[model samples]
Target chain A: MKEETIINFTHHQTAHCENGVVSNLMKHNGFSVSEPMVFGIGSGLLFCYIPFLKVNHAPVITYRAMPGHIFKKFAKRTGIKMKREKFSNPKEAQSKLDENLERNNPVGLQVGVYNLLYFPDEYRFHFNAHNMVVYGKQDGRYLISDPVMEEVTSLSEKELEKVRFAKGAFAPKGHMYYPISFPEKLELEKAIVSGIKDTCKTMLAPIPIVGVKGIKTIANLIRKWPKKKGIKTANHYLGQVVRMQEEIGTGGGGFRYIYAAFLQESGKLIGNEKLIELAKEMTEIGDLWRDFAVEASRIYKNRSRNDAGQSENYNQVANQLDHIADLEKVFFKKLKKAI
Target chain B: MKKEEVPQDKSNLESANFRELCYAIDENGEYTTANSTGWEPKTVALNNAIDEINDRIEDAKKRVLEGKTSPIEYHMELHKMDVGILASYVGLWQWRVKRHFKPSVFKKLKMNTLQKYAEVFEISVDELKTIK
Candidate 1:
């Protein structure tokens, strides 16, 4: 009976609410746990738990990459051509600038030169590259100005002068252009990190219910008891479920509704035998969810470390998450029989 | 056709010469070789000519260091003047030391030293090949 309580507690509504607590824990640990957690929870439920519940729903996955052809109309509307060039040394890649400058020269006659430095490479793509200076020839001598000076104009002459006079001043500036402003870089970095955080938050959305499989398992065990004790034990399990639902609702109202629906639908089935089986199946599903959440949390930690520039441990953590997902699929097959 | 016309033409020439002299003085701190190479008068004048050319080269070098004149400018200026020719001449004077020297050697030296300068001038290595 005690073991059933533990299992039911682990597999009930309150388990999902633990995500908020974990998020606060992440904050306390000084790591931005927002994105990976969301992605983990949302993806975990979609890929792991939804099939267990026999819910016919499809999950949408979004990632950062080049836009699809549907965006071609928007591209024409914006009149912006996104083309990129690669150079070993950004400063040494004179031909690229010369070619671009020549193409833009006719337009420059009216609007000034727009010799923007572009980072077309995936690794070097950054917003800061918009502030770098572009150098070219006017008449028969050298000329220099901000590459994206037309777009962002806060770059001061003094800053340009300082860059012009720096050591190895003749060395070709690299293709990875960064804005002259540190504040801009910081802001851009934060936005990028925030996007990743949001994704994590979405992934972890189903965790509260998944976290409390113990209560569900206990409910099943109580239903299996002698008729005299069964009512009392079942009432205790009901009380636990209600409490778990309340906790989950307090943290995030979404899981509360989900749990309530699960209870309402399962309650309509006749006989204690069917109820016991449903509880048992839910308990198993809850355990898988808990395992998935733990693994997802671990993966998030590793991904956060990777974002912090630690690549060595990232692969190992990713592999572990893959293994956990595979395990969930197996459990999902078993839970589907109950449905 | 008159005496006045002759004096006017002579004055025009003199003014042009004076302007050239002033430019040289401002640029090289000497006036003797302002109009043309002051090499025919004597060894002192010939030495002064060399000194003035060297002064111009030194100024160009300083500008390169200061990121003012780019490598393309330096290479182009080298083509416009007789500095490389003079350096080759001096190298020939020490034939024993310069016997193994070749045009390729000079090219390699130029590329290695002036590559950074060319980058500053926004001239690619491929473009630098077309300069000569």
Candidate 2:
């Protein structure tokens, strides 16, 4: 006999998946942490261009930190005790998940995006780092709260198992996590300060492949791509950049808007006027990134518009990125001072 | 973007009955969340990616029909997998997977070998042996 259980879990849609799951789970555990706060405290924003790591036959250009990093960092900074487990055997994984549900425990699960049947058709791809919460089991189906979705959904036992053990890069391996305990009081002000400091240091890091320097490196490549790799491959690479920035549940502008919102809330909470001022500046920067995406997409979509015009468009977008990089360099320096 | 300026452009996602959340500055000059049907630039990029995948699948189907490559290649493309990913799923080396792409090599694959691939693709052994 199957024991049916459903824990009362609320679903709140957010701009990104991991942050959404983290925020929602915290709420269920009686801590009302907003999505942007979770993102900010976790220091989730980042820019890295790894040339050797190929995803979909193009170089990996990531706009944020790696999968699971946000939740891990958020828990650590807030002094939340979380229990995480991974299983090598599917049967064991299934039984463990069932046991948790029987005890009315809601758990966050790392899964592959490809096999998630509820995803929109266009968003279904072989990406392996998606996260969701499983709060209940009823009639042999698992109730799911995918942070990217507008409402809660469900999946059959076989379907959930497939994604949990999905193959390829960053495979889930049946990974599940949930909060076991929390500090009597969260040190929000200190966490926010440290988070801001860490982010500032990362963005200003002295490295070619990460932070502000990485943004410049991509801008340089955008200018060279048309001539170096020919129009077709160059356009494909440009599409990859846009997809990473806009798609993948980023809430747009590669999380700049979310970070700005975080700063605004943090400023109000900690009574820091400087952070409020910088939040406005960050919003403008996010707008600049959206503008860059527009121009980049135009170039890729209209490659046959004209050769001279195409190269000119590429340069224009590259210039836009360079300008954003410069702005970010200044912004992070200011943010570091403000905090 | 301003809350009012948050784009609600008609996009492919609209047909999917989903709205993505966006953070923007509202009328009060405060940050707030809004639901976006889609943005044009993102839609174009997303469509381009989907088109590319569809094109690859079509090309793979043509090759399989001509017996130029094995059914494995077509099925892999259909599943949005490349050599590296497919190899990982099947617990085989990438080079080995590539070698099996030849029609001749695929024809003589052992039952267990074929079973491994069938399980990965979620198809039957006989189904894996032929092009759809």
Candidate 3:
């Protein structure tokens, strides 16, 4: 007679969602892995500015690895047994999740950001790849451990289903996963080397819309905002960038700081002083990202009353992004050789 | 974000019973910690998005009251989705969704289509048929 049950899931708040969800799930499953360590070993550091991919009429610029990649890579690196499932039928998915929870297992879920009632109305959007965990159900509520929030929250079963099957880019499709077990030995050094190499490769990729090239492309487009797009249009675009970098649950610096934290932990674990140095540089670069957001925000402070937007202001912010791109190029190359 | 820079006046943050925790570079330039109070810019970013959503809702509600559209359109607006997004969830094409916006077509929508939208919105088919 399997029925409703609540797992004693201890929630530890962290910088990013996927990293936090997987980290907390690991902890509940008897593995001791820090959020940053999970982030690092999974090769979560990345910069892709795919301009053609539009969300809300702006280019998709991201500062981390693609969704679900970190968890997949982390499980593989640590030799942990993990199970993931997606359902064509929401009812089946909910039943499977209920069965898992009935056994006291906490399940990680990917959901859209727009419909979670606990989310600040201002922060809700059509973003479809946010991650959280469901530990149990009681009465008519699903207990959720969303890492970005300060505390655990509850969602109605119906509300949970709506978000689970939310449509758009990177749709969750009722996706859920749980860790089964882990090997005694972890391949830390091997994972570190591969992570550094992949990050460098993405930065040096030849395509103009990815890696460092993509940053350059975005910089050029941003610089032309005032002249080509006009003040009102420029304000809208700049606000969009700020929203992507600062708001979209990045926690900070478009998630560069989290990757930087990962680098720090990996450095100490592997005793690579050079990695420590690279981590410091990454932190500095992360500051530059914050600076870019601040300056861009200054350019269009009040969208309704903004009258001072200039080509120079747009160009100046563009130069800073280009500068950041160049700095990342240097950091990634050094990271590639630091190992 | 710095401790001094946290915004304490965002009403929605408290209303939703949600608080944002951020990773900020400390004095030693390390990113190993987190701050859950609030950041000014992050709060502002959210405030902007909420404003956008509310604006859409207001526009959508106006459209529906005038009989230019149906409750499906208003619900989608409240959810901050376009026809493309709503279509994908309902497994319908964008044109069908566009047609669904019209009251005449929406009234004749099959039970299956109505059920799909009801599931998407977390509302009943009866409620979905009438805009509040």
Off by over 4 Å in 3: A1-4, A305-309, B1-12, B25-31, B54-75, B100-132
TM-score of 3: 0.88
Residue-wise C-alpha lDDT for candidate 2, range A98-195, written one tens digit per residue: 99988888999999988888887778788888999999998899999999889899999999999999999998999999999999998899989988
**Model 1 C-alpha lDDT per residue in residues A154-245, reported as the tens digit of each score:** 22233333232222212223232211111211122223223323323433334522212322322233234224333323222222222222
What are the per-residue Cα lDDT tens digits for candidate 2 across B13-110?
A: 76668898999988888999899999888888777777777788899889988999999999998888999899999999999999899989998999
> Which ranges of candidate 2 are over 4 A from the true structure?
A303-306
Enumerate residue pairs that collide in model 2.
none
Candidate with top TM-score is 2
Residue A243, candidate 2: C-alpha displacement in angstroms: 0.9
Which candidate wins on DockQ?
Answer: 2
Ranking by lDDT: 2, 3, 1
Ten contiguous residues with the weakest lDDT in model 3 chain A: A300-309
Instruction: Rank candidates, TM-score, best first.
Output: 2, 3, 1
- Looking only at chain B, model 2 earns a TM-score of 0.92
Give candidates' CA RMSD values in order. Answer: 34.4, 1.4, 3.1
Error of 2 at A82 (Å): 1.1
Candidate 1 chain A weakest ten by summed lDDT: A1-10
